[model samples]
Every structure is written in C-alpha cells, then in structure tokens.
Target chain A: MSTATETPAQHGLAAHSHGAGTKSVKGALDRFASFDVADHSVPHGREEEWRFVPMSRLRGLHDDAALDGSDYTVAVDVDPRVTATSVGADDSRKGSSTYVPVDRPSARAWAAAEKTFTVDIPRDEIIERPSVIRLTGTSADRGAAGHLVITAGRHSKSVVVIEYDGSSSFVENVEVVAEDGAELTVVAVQDWADDAVHLAHHHVHVGRDATVKHAVITFGGDLVRNGTTLNYAGPGGDATLLGLYYADAGQFIENRLVVDHNTPNAKSDVEYKGALQGKSAHAVWVGDVLIRKEATGINTYELNRNLVLTDGARADSVPNLEIETGEIEGAGHASATGRFDDEQLFYLRARGIPEDLARKLVVRGFFASLINRIGVPEIKDRLMTTVERELAVAEELAAEAAGDA
Target chain B: MSTLEIRDLHVSVETENGPVQILHGVNLTVNSGQTHAIMGPNGSGKSTLAYALAGHPKYTVTSGSLTLDGEDLLEMTPDERARAGMFLAMQYPVEVPGVSVSNFLRSAKTAIDGEAPKLRTWVKDVKTAMDNLRIDPEFSERDLNTGFSGGEKKRHEILQLELLNPTFAVLDETDSGLDIDALRIVSDGVNRFSSGGDKGVLLITHYTRILRYIKPDFVHVFVGGKVAEEGGPELAEKLEEHGYADYVGEGAAV
Candidate 1:
C-alpha cells in the first residue's frame, strides 16, 4: 500500500541524472535497436521484458525458430488512388520509417521475410474508405514471418486496418510512418484461432506537425504478445495509442509499449484496457515513456487499466515514466487493476437487472469508450458483439466449474 | 392492497472486530397509498434499516422476518425482491461507464416486466418523465451516473423510481445532499409515484426539509436504533422546530 504514493522513478528503473548538454545514455529496459538478430539475445523468460510472458507458450518465437514457412496468405483491399505493392525484401521503401527491431523475434522477422508489403497514401489526399489487410493462417505447426510498411504521404489523411485470424505460429514487424502534416490511423485486429501463437512488433514514427493514431484490439489466440513503439522524427508531432484485449480461459495476452519523446513540443497519449476471466487467464500491460533532455515543452500521459472478472485469473500492469528534464509541459502515468465491482452489480440487481445481465453491462461499459475510438463502425460493432459472446462463454465455464465443485 | 411488514428485525454489519449490531428489534408495517418517514439523528441506524429492507448483503438479518403481501422477502435475492415490486433509490448511485441511461432503463424495465417495453410508448414515457423532472434531453444519452453532480444523482434515482413503478420504495437519505430546487423536484417525483394509490413508501431522512414537500401519513422518531415514538405529520414540524434534543440527551445527537 505504501507504494501507492511512490513516484514512477522509484517504482520502475531510474537512470543517471546529468546537466544540460550531456551526452545521451540508455537506461534499463531501453533495448538497442538493430536489424541483425545477433544484436539481441534469446530470451529465457528471465529478462525484464519477457518475465511476465509465458516463454514456453511462445512456440520458439523468442528463440531460434525457423521463419521461412509459407503457410499463411495476405490479402489487401485499397482504393485506386493508393498504391498497394509487394516489393522485394531489399526495397528502398522498406526502412523509410525511423524504427528498428529491438528484440530477437522482430529482428529475425525482418531478416527472414522475403516480401515487404507496402501501402503508400498519396500526398494531400483524403482517403474515403480504409484500406483493409487480411491475413489468415492455414497451419498451426508451421512458423511464418512477415513485414509491412505503411507510409502516409505529406499532409495526406487515411486509415489502414489489418485483420489476423486462424491458427499459426507467427512473428511480424509492422512499420508506420506519418509524413509532415499528415494524419494517419492504423487499426490492427488480432482475432486469431484458439491454437494460434503470435508475436507482433509495431513501430511508429511521426514527422513534423503530423498526427498518428494506432489502435490494437485482440480477442483470440492461445498466446499473443504485442510490442509497440512510438518515436517523433521532428518537432510538434502528435500521437495517440489505444489498445483493448480480452483474455479468456487458458489465454495469455501481453501488450508492451514505449513512447520516446526525442523531439521538442510533441504530444502523446496512451491508453490500454483489458479484461481477464476463468482459470489461468493472464493479461499484462507495460507502458514506458521517456522524455529526453532536449525534448522540452512535451505533454504526455499513459494509462493502463485491467478488470479481473473471476477467481484464479491474473493481470499485471506496470507504468514507467523517465524524465530527463523538468521543462516539459507535463508527464504522468497511471495503472490500476480492479476486480468485478460487487457494488456495481448490487446497484444493478436492486433495479431489477439479473446478475448475469448486470455483469455483461458492466463489462461492456468498461470497454465502450475505448472501442468507440477505433473510428471504424463495422470494427467497433463486431468487437462489441465479440465481447458480449466472451462474457457469456466465461459465465458458462464458471457455472460448470461450480457444478463440478 | 399490498402491505410490506417488518417484524422485530435485528440487523448487524461485519467490521474488523466482528459483527456489530446496528438495528435492534424494529417493527413497521407500510400499506399501499401510505407514506412513512423514519427520522433519527446520526448513528441511530436509519440507513441500516433502509439497507436491511433492500436486502443489501452487508447487513445480516439476525432475527425476525420481512415480507410483502405474506410472501417472505428474506428468501428473495435483490433482483427477485425488485421483481416482486421492491425498489430502492440508493444514497450514492454507482457510476457505470459506457452504459447509456436509456439502455439501462430499458433493460431494467424488461427485467421487471419479463418482456421488453413497446418502443414508441416507452420512449414517450421516458421523455415525459425526464421533461417533468426538468432533466436535459441529452441527459439520457450520457453514461449512467458518470460525472453526475449530487443533485443530478438524486434526480436520476427518482427517475428510476418512476420508470420502474415498484409497489414499495425504500429511499435512504435521498434528501441528504439535495438543494432546495432539487429537493422539491425529487419530492414531487415521489409524490407522483405514491399518488397512484397502490404504492407503499419507506422514506428515511435525517432532516425535515424534504418532509415539508412530501407529506407522510406516519412519522416515526428513531433513536438508539429503535423507534422512540410514532405520530402523524405534525410530529415532523415539531421536531423541525425543537430538533431531536428531546429524543436523545443534550449534545448526544452528535
């Protein structure tokens, strides 16, 4: 309880303090970015980033797994104004974004993917409909890797949605870049099958005066770990990151994010909420925001909230903020894990709402605002229905377990 | 007519030290078209009796029984009690984010009536009710009780009272935080509910300000977790002028 009053620096890793003009240094949890897999060591479930993740269930994604299998297919739907092309691995547009893989799986995926799917939005054009990318896995035994680069041309506005489903052992790297004065929104929906194991790293770079919105909604998959990073390429960039995941029985879901404010006068906000139910259902959220010495006048806040619906389920939330200078506008972080509130249920029941229906309402209310921010009506409606289904299934399982007892 | 009877009810709540009894033997019977006000000083267990009637899990009924029309209320869960025509306007309404007031009202109505309401008539009823209560048209679109002010929360509670149309209502300190205007509005709402001549009410309060608006047929002076005296409307005016000093000792009301 005493830790509630402690600052983020005391709760998480703290770095060295130096005067102005001092050379920059990396702190703990700040892994170096590289294209070579050798630059990153294989995780053994003991590292700071991989500690909360179940390493055994990752299916060698964090180790030396072969990533050349062609058991998955990719489909893209884009308007004639936009260009959707699959270029060679060594194309010039591959590494246009200010991002590099900071983990072994990401670096391995970057090296092993033979084709780079690129989506380019023309300059100053506002796309009427979102470009859709759908990936389906055919085999759970075979491993696959993929790389996707989406570039929003200068002052252009567009939204790209990526959907993943079916069973497979997969790793991928997604690069997003918003050029100067552009507005871009990228939504990734991970509705994989029960046997699927996936590891995804999404890196975003915001240019001068640009705005970027990234949303992640995960509903299925036996083991899923998503790592997202945000960096400002120039000054006055704005970024918003939103995530919502529901982990059912025997499901493991992890979302780790890093927001690096390297340029001045930039603004960023991160919000991720999750719900877990049933035995051995685990959910994890790790948010880190770093404000460098030169990054003045920046405003940033990160929030992570989790709701545990039943007994034997677990949720881990860690929010870390490192400030190198106090000249910024403001920076803060918040993390909280609350159980299904009995008081809420009691209030509803007193109003003639049954216990089951009341529980569904509360959970739906918990995720409503965040899901609405996805800005895609079809996706939002589908996700809402999926959440309702999940709650019903969870209740049925709880009833069965009680009957057995 | 329906009758709610509480016979020698003894209730206790769990604390760190163990069970602490809050309500001694309390006997009261409320019939349809009758309004009863329970007035007491702080720590007189006024809220406990209200919670005990609403079937809150925190308050344990150690002795006696509660029934509506000879049906045992003790055996019914909170929702069952509600479906049996019981409603409680909580002192502090819980905030449920993302659930619109319209949706919640519809769901509760469905649950109570065992079927969904007619869309056109229900919508018109809700609008008329909200308009009569002086609530904004946009109020029903907002999340239930989220970011609502004290007065707004009180009005919303009364709104539920009218929409649910229960046979009996137990209002616990509904007037504690309301201002004069909001109090009048809420009192009016309660008046409208009981005017149907087939509903019962157990209004609990610590002040007589709300009594001036909604007249009670019976007023019971509660002290030390038991009823000290029972009377009609004039008793409320008397207490308003003299205060609870006669019921409890000097400075004991604190």
Candidate 2:
C-alpha cells in the first residue's frame, strides 16, 4: 500500500570502510617479482604460478626453443588517425612502451621476434571508428613468435581490436601504454583453430588520470594461457578489465591477471566469466591485487564465476588481495563455480520452455551482464553466436555420455 | 471446455534415508471457468497438491490418476505438462541470474505455441500485459525474478498468466508475501483469465484475506492430505469465522 524504494546493494557482502582488505590477508603473503625474465626458469609444474599448468604439453614454449618460422599473416583495417607499421627492433616505440618480460615464455618471445608490429595513436587525436588487426596462421605444425606494441598518446582516445584465428604453435608478447589523460579500449579475441596452441603475456601501463578498458575473449584452442598485468603510473587513473572464455572437450583455457595499485586516488575493477563442457574440459581464473602502503584512496573489486555444463568438466577459481595499508576507499572480491541451477531449470520448465531451450536461456543469461559491458555491438553479437555454438556441442556430448551409460 | 480431474493422488519425496510419503489419497475436480480455493494449515499437503499436478520430479506419484480433458497427466514430464496447458505459480519463484524477463517469456510462448510469435505484435502484446499488471517496462530487460521484491514477483507471475493464457492454473500461496495493493492486482489478473469462461483456476491459500478479492466459486477445506469438507462460497465464510479447528482435532493425522 505504501511506496517504498528497496534498492538492494550491488554485492551481497557487507560493506566495511576500514581494514576491509586487511581481513583478506589470511594466509602468508604471496610473492610478486619485478618483470625480469632471467629470474624465472623453465617451470616443472611445482611453482605456485605454474602448478595448475600442464607442463608436458607446452611444446617447448617454456624452454628456449628457436621461434624460427613465419607461420602467421597480419592484416589491419587502418583508420586515418591510426597507422600500423613494421619497424626494426631499434624503433623508439618498439621497446619504449610497457615492454617487460614477466616470465620465461615471454622472454623467449622477446628474444626470437623478427620484427615488431607497432600501432600508434597520435597525441590529442580521437578516432571515431575502431581499428581492426587480425592474425591468421598459415599452418599448424610450424612454430611462430611475434611482438606487438600499441600506444595511445597523451589526451588521445581510440579503440583497437586484435583478433587471432587459424591453427599453429604460437608465443607472443604484447605491450599497451595509455599516456596521461588518454582513453583507450583494447579488445583481444583468441578464436583459434582446433589445434592451435598460444601462450601470451600482456603488460599495460596507465598514466595520470587515464582510462583504459581492456577485454580478453578466449575460445577455440587446444591449449591457451594468457597473463596480464596492469600497473598505474599516476594518480586518478581508472582501469576496467574484463574476460570471457569457453573451453570445450579436452581443452585448457586459463587467465591470470594482476592489478597493482601503486598510486593514490586510482580505481580498478576486474570481472571474468567462463563456462566449460565435455570430458576433460578445464578452465581456470586467478586474480591478484596488491595495494602499496602509499596507494591511499583506492577502490578495487574483482568477481569471477564459472559454470560447468556437463560431466567431467572442471573449473578452478582463486582471488587474492594483498594490502600494505588499510587506509583506502574499499576492496573486496567474490568467486563461485557450479553446475546448472536446478531451481532455475524448474522455474523455466514450469513456464513451458522445453528443457533444452530452457538450458540455453539460462547459460546465455549467465554471460549477458559481462557481454553488455563490452559496449560494442559487433563483438557482442559474435560472442553470442559463439556461446550458442558451444551450448550445442555440450548438449550433443551430454547425449552421447548418457547413451553410453 | 476442459476439465482437470485428480483422483486418489498419492505422492512421495526421496529423503536422505529413503522415500517419505507426503500426500495420501487426495481427490478433487476443477472444471473450466470455475475458481476452486483449497485452504489448509502448514504441512497439511496443500502445496504438495500443486507440485503433484505440475509434475515435479521430486514428487513421485505412487498411485494416482491425473487427467487434462482425458489425457494422462502423470505420464508427462514437467515441460510436457506445462506445454499441455497446465500452470503452477510457485510460492517462491526462483531467481535466474542472466536470463532477461522478455527473452524467457518469448521462449516459453514459442515452445508452447509450436512457433515463434509474430515479432511486430509480440512486442506490443508483452507491453500491454506488463502495463495491465502495473509492472514497469524496464523490468522486461532485467534478469528473471532476480533482485525483485515480493510484490514484483507476484505481479510477474500474473503477467505470465495473462500472456501465456493457460487452460488451468494452480496458484500456490500467491498472496502470502504480497501487500494489499499487490494482492488486488494479482486477484484481478486471475479474474481476467477466468472471465473468458474457458480457463480454470486452483487457488491454494492459507488465509481468507485473498478470497475477499478473488471471490472463489467453490471452497474446499483440506486436512491430513484429504478434503475434509466442501461447499459453495459460504464454506469459506464459515471457516473464516470459526477456523479449521472443528475439522482438524488435536494433531490427529498428517
């Protein structure tokens, strides 16, 4: 009878203003090192960072094998304000932007690169249309390596989309730089062939008061490992990192991200969602945030959720936050991994939606929120189609498994 | 035009130990255009009847005969039963995280109708139905039942009833969590469905407050999984004044 506004809090967790991040410091502090390749060696699956990875299947990307082949072709749809050029290793922008090797795989990618593919957005210029860069592999057996540098000049605004396709053995290093007061959006899509193997590391640096929206969408690979690090150089910077991945039968897809809040008055948010299906399908997400003692007045939160669609599919999720000082805006995280919700299924079925279609609706709905955050229609539509295809395959596999039983 | 016949229905659920019986030899008949209200106390198998008719897998019908116009209902799956024009408004509507209300409604309608609804008119039809239920237009884009208030959930159920237009509906305690205004709106929606004189409603409730607005044509007092008594609307009036104390003696049977 009365008009009352009941707006529930966005997150179900209780809001704590003081010492919120300190409470998450339960275990002994985890270690983080500077971006030095020599400090790391070939992993034998025993290290904390490399424990979840299957080392035997890496195809020597972990070791110092010569990346001696040009098995992929690079194509770009150029914008007037944006230009892509192949430069020698000595180009000022080649290694000047956020270029640092975090681990051995990245260092190997650096040492074996033939040339650098560099795309630069000039200072104070805004590009209305998005630029597209596509890499297509020539074959599956040949091993390939490459390096890429993308930079947005001071006060410039632009969007760059990088897409990967075809099948091959690949290792690559990527560097992204957002200068002071610039706004940049980078969307990297890994849509490989069924036999492709890709290992990559992406390092991003944000300048004073800059804004960067970075998204990684991974699908269609036998094995893929992607690592990203975001470090702010000045105060008032904002970064939004999003990832969506789908892993099918006998596939491994993992994303590891670290957001280092080293400056005061900055914000960072990370959200990643994945769905796994079929036998031996595996997906993993690891998020780590470190706030230095000087990084006061910071707001950060991360959420990761996984949906396992069929039997034998596995999902691993871990979120860790390390804060040196509790004097900050707020910090928290949430993670969950579960199968299809029976209550939701029954609710939809009671509405006369057949069980199969009801399941599709529920799965698609799980990704709807993250997909909308992408803010680009073409990518959103294409991702929806990809999700639908994954659901179909999962359904067929479930049927076959049931038949065998 | 249609008749939902339930005869000697017995249902049970599986617990950690073993099978546990819930309903024993219950019988009722709801013909088209009739509003029959079943009033009972908690744990008296009132909600079990609603779930049993909806073909919930957890509820095993050991012995019973449920028919929708002479077709076997007990043999059908939950979705099949819904497709056969049976509806059950749950007491606690589940929250689906990612599915939007508009998409879910469209998918359900298409599944039941055997074809996709005409795009141009379907949008208008949904708008009209939502407007009639006093539901905001933006709710169509939100996740299905997630983060919705109690009143909002009840109104959404009624919205589906108006749009889906089922032949028979089993509403289980739809008025429990609703405010007075929401109760009236939900009652009006049910009234509109039966006003067509081709749809039947089985209203399961614990209070007589909703009956003041719904105005059932028949009232049945349920106790111990059995229909203790039945009569015209006057039965509800009598029970409202006195209570089920006359029929249910001191925790006699369950």
Candidate 3:
C-alpha cells in the first residue's frame, strides 16, 4: 500500500459506487494524508464529514489551540507476554505501520505529541489475560494530544483494552499492526465525563493470514468522534470491527470507518449498533468499504442499526460499498435506523413485566449480542453494569420530556 | 370462586382513516370450574376480545364494563391485570431477541407473585413443566421466541399458562397452526391447568378441533362481533358437522 498521497486525484479509485457526493469528491481512501498540521485545513460545518458534527463543540482541537495539556494520567496492566513503555517521537517503531494522519485533528494530534505509548507482544506467545490500559483526564479546562501504537509479533495472540474516563478535550491517533499468523483483539472504550470532548482516529494494518478484532464502546462524553481505517497488508487477512454506543440528551457521538481491501482473498465484517434518547441526542455512523481491482475472491459485509427512543432524538446511518471488481466472492451492506419497537414493549409488558422494566429489557437486549461478541469476560460484566446505569438516566430523561410535553 | 364478567363491551381500533369499531356490545361470563369456547369465523372480532381483555393499548374500550370479581379491570394496566390473575396466550407471540426464555419467565413470575420465586423450587418447577411439554432443556437459554417454529411458539405459550397459573386464561386461537401431535401436547398442558378445578377458561378459535380434547361446558357461536348462538358442547359438534353455514350464510362459511 502506498503511504504518500501527494497526487491524491491520480491515486483514488475511479467510478466506484458509494459515498458519491456525500463524502469527499473522490473515494474515502483518497482523502489528503500528511503528518504536518498545516497540510490539512480546518473544517466548517458545511463539509460532508463535518456536517453531522458541531464544530464549536470540538474545543479548538481542529484549529490552532495548543494540545500540550498534561492534566491526565495513564496506567497500564499487561499480561506476562506483553511490555508497555513510552518512546520518543523518533522511535523507529513509531510509524512502522506506514499510516499517516488523514484529518486535521489526527494530524494535529500526531504533530503535538512528544511521546507515544507502545505495547508489544512477543512472537509465538499466547496471552492468557488481556492487557488493560486506563487513561483518566483530571480536568476538561484544557485540551490534550495523545498517540498509541500496538504491535503483535508473528504467530502470537493477545487482547488489549484501553479505557478512558474523567474529562478533557482530547485528540488521539491509534496505530495497530499485526504480523503474519498473529491474532489480535483491541477494544477502546470512551467513557468520558459529560463535559469532555474527544476526537480519535484508529488506523489498523492487518498482516498476512492474520486476524484482528477491534471494538469501540462509546457511552459518555459531550462530543466524541471516532474514525477508523482498516488496511489489508497481505492476502487472507481477516478483520472484524464492532462498535456499541449510546448518546443521551445534549450529547453527540459519531463513528466513521473505512475498510480498504487492496489485497486478494481477504475478509472484513463491520457491525455497529447505537441508541439515542432525550432531546437533541444525536448518533451518527458512516461505513465505507472499497474492493480494489486487485482484490479478488474477497468477502465483505457491513451493517449499522440505530434505535431512536423518543421524539427529538435522531440517529443517522450511512453505509457505502464500492466494488471495482466483480470477481470477488460476495459484498453487501445494510443500514437501518428505526424507532423503539412498540410491539416488543407490548409483548414484555403483557407478560407481567412492568413498563419501566420492560423498556430496560428491550434496551439491554439491543446491546447484548454485540457485547457478547466482544469476547472479553472481565470487561463484559462491567459493561453491562454501565449499560444499566445509562438506562436509568435515559428513563429519567424520557419521563422529564413526557412531563414537559 | 372467581368470575370474569364482560357486560355489553364495545371496542374500536384506530386506522389511518378513523376509529373502526371491531367489537360491538358483546356479553359473556366465565365462572371458575367452567370452560367457555367462543368459536368464530375470520374477522369476527374474537382476537379483539382477547386483546381488549388484556388491556392492549391498540384497542379502546369505548363503552364497557370488564370486571373480575366486581373489580373494574379497565382501570388496571396489563401487568397489573396479570397480577390480578388474568393471562392471554397470544396466537402470534412477538419475538424478543437477546432475552433468554429462562430470564423472561422468571421475570414474569416475579411480577405476578410480587416476589422472586425460591431458586431451588423455581428451577425444578420450570424443568418439570418443560419436560412435560417435551421442550429441549437448552431451549431455555435461547432468545425468547426468536427463530422458533410454529409448534415451538405455541408450546411455549402453553408452558407459560401452566407455570403462571392465572385464575382465568383467554387462549386466542392457540390451535390455529399446530399439527396433531403439537395440538395434543398443548391441549394436555391446558387441561393440566384447568384440572385444578378452580380455573376459568375462555377458549377462542375458528375451529372445533381443540374442543374435542378439552371439552367446554358452554359453546358460544360468534358472528359479526356478537354471539349468534349459545349452547352446550353439542353446539360445537353441530358446528363441526355444518361448518357455521347456518349462522354466517352459506356464502360466508369457510
């Protein structure tokens, strides 16, 4: 895969079907890429990518504000086969995945960070327990820049979970590389406080015959945007990307992802589910899959589902699939945004479950399958507890809206 | 003994045009230790009566007095009505994905009993009930009604009828889509519930096949939202022979 996009017009795929005029003029992959912040321009709300996001809520992460705040602390707990350390920007392994920043906030985050947190899994070792990393922001008064790199050696298997909480205006760029025959799982949970603003970009490079499972759980934060890019480094590379998010009243959560199938005999599956409640609760999901001319016998499917609980709550889902070659096995995409199912609620309530508890059960069931597929036992229970707490708050907000109406 | 009295009940459902009345001044009484079979042709409002009795939001009781032992049932929500000893085995049970059958049953039992059941006895009771119904033990772990066949869904409804043990059960076309074996199994389960000798049953169906298994003391022929004729079990046998042509006109008989 080419790392530089000096002549993006010539490099972009031509005449592909999806995201025609909604995203950038070209395909999603041909977007300007660079490490220097000056190369990318600040986005106004009118831009297709920024249309769904409120630019004012970014806290100047996209513009000239300094991202040098140190009001945060990081803690890491790793399995015996893994090592966690911080390296200077000049570390040889920093950009080993050959991924450059795609957006202004991503570029700014890369240019502003002096050090990167790195996690390494040695070759041929199977990790028994997942490595856990926790980053907590002490205050939201100032913004911060963050960078992380996770590399899995050949034939090894490991799971890494990074959890974020507290409050801050944070921008981050994450790079993941899996070597041949490696199996890697990475989960990034954004559980920030209601006052926090977060913008993150995750670029994953899948190696030959390797498998990677990546999940993002976004439940809190005043405004959060997560953009992920998946690139296949060799044939038979398989990637499963899953996400679960809930946006409450006055909150904005957006997830944008693209999968580039530039290699043959590769597979990719993306599924994201979200629920929104209360006034002005907004959740947006944009999924793009591109099957290049060289990507033959490839199989890919992407699905997005959103449930809107009450009036004035909105969910936007857009799925685009572009296949330049018909020689691939199969390619399909489905997107659905629907209101809370009244028939399911009535069924539960008629079975002697009270209305409130019935609603809770429906919402819980909505996120259960996705959470179970995360496959991390330690985090599953904690995630369910968090879901219940969020449901309590959502119910209160719904009741308040009902009373006002 | 408990008595459910539906006196001159009227119901209407909202459509795109306006409110269309489905049930017009229907009267019936179900007493403990007695089974009343309400046989009707298609679109005769038999299902509407079941839903209205269970307080489904889609049906409006424009004017009616629905009472269980002299207490107004219209004032209660669906859950409260279940706690008051009323159950409706829906013909088309909605599938609730990601909620296991075991959890859903336990929750409904808790709500009806006002407390959680003893874990030991509850598990044993559920196991015994499921075993009698010939349901696989692993079925309890699967999502409720999701991907279930027609027979499995009907059997699950009967299982709830046996476990919840409500005072009155309104079985709405429970025998509609079942084969002979499944029909017999579901009827046996219903008979087990009614065999307690203190439960009232209002069995609603378009056919008399299930009446042969669980005989009803009274048979009411429903036509055009009201009872066209009322008699003993002999009425069901007669309808089986003539097929409702005597009541609904030869042109309308199925």
Best by DockQ: 1
Per-residue lDDT for A170-282 in model 3, tens only?
99989999999899999999999999999999999999999999999999999999999999889999999999998898999999998989999999999999988888999
B161-232, model 3: which lDDT tens digit per residue? 998999999999999999999999999999999996699999999999999899999999988777878999
Question: For each candidate, what is chain B's TM-score?
Answer: 0.96, 0.97, 0.97
List model 1 lDDT by residue over A13-119, tens digit each: 22322331123336533567799999898989888889988898887877887888888888889888999888999988788886788889999999999999999
Q: What fraction of native interface contacts does model 2 preserve?
A: 0.81
Reference-based lDDT, each prediction:
0.88, 0.84, 0.88
lDDT of 2: 0.84
Quote model 2's iRMS: 1.3
What's the TM-score of each model vs. the native? Answer: 0.86, 0.83, 0.83
List the candidates ranked by DockQ, beginning with the highest.
Answer: 1, 2, 3
- CAPRI-wise, candidate 2 is medium
Estimate, for each residue in A49-88, the C-alpha lDDT of model 2 and write its tens digit.
Answer: 7888888778877876657778888999968779887887
Between 1 and 3, whose TM-score is larger? Answer: 1
Q: Between prediction 2 and prediction 3, which has the larger DockQ? A: 2
CAPRI band for model 3: acceptable
In model 1, the runs with Cα more than 4 Å from the true position are A1-31, A90-97, A180-182, A206-211, A233-238, A261-269, A291-312, A321-339, A367-369, B15-18, B40-44, B221-224, B228-254
True contacts kept of 1: 0.82
